[model samples]
Target: MMTILIPATVAAVLGGFALRIWYRRWKQQRIEANRKVEAPNSYYSSRGVRQQEDRERWHSIKVGTLHPLNREEVLRLLDVVDEDGVSSLSRKDRLFLDNMTLPRMGV
Candidate 1:
């Protein structure tokens, strides 16, 4: 009787554990099934607007058709950097500095 009772108790505990695991997996699957997936381009829809504009401007500058910034423009940019620190500049401002200081790749 004692031997039979021990085995029965062990089997009951294991059965309960297995049932619990199955219920949790079922719950997770239901949650996943009900979840709404975002469109691939949705992430970029509103994000990076400024970065995109900066890239377009940089590309235009790199085309080399635009004349180099005049002396006054350069001075104004420098003064802003000097007074407020470099981080105060906008993306366009920073890109202008990049274009002026960095050597042209081919020429």
Candidate 2:
């Protein structure tokens, strides 16, 4: 009886220790995951800078005004559309295309 009790008691203590270690590790992993989720990626940070510059350029242009682009400028935009889908164009680029096409549409 004494021998059986001693081994069972030892196993319970060891199991408690094991559970404690596993719980601590799980908690640490959760913290690390949260940090990763919260962290700002450098790629996105740089993209944001580019986007801000585009916004500033967009603001400088007058609305409801026809701003004609040079041949190279027009080709550059077309090349961008061909390389990357139309969805890749910024709001200002889309507006430029819209204004340019409006006259051709006979509207």
Highest-TM-score candidate? 1
Candidate 1 per-residue lDDT over residues 1-107, each given as its tens digit: 99999999999999999999999999999999999988774534443564444334433433343345544565676677657655578978876656755453333
Instruction: Report the C-alpha lDDT of model 2 over 1-107, residue by residue, as the tens digit.
Output: 99999999999999999999999999999998888453563334466575454444433434345434444455566677667756689888767755544232112
TM-score of predicted model 2?
A: 0.34
Off by over 4 Å in 2: 36-107
Which residue runs does candidate 1 get wrong by more than 4 Å?
Answer: 1-4, 50-107
Looking at model 1, which ten-residue stretch has the lowest summed lDDT? Answer: 57-66
For candidate 2, the clash count comes to 0
| RMSD, candidate 2, Å | 11.2
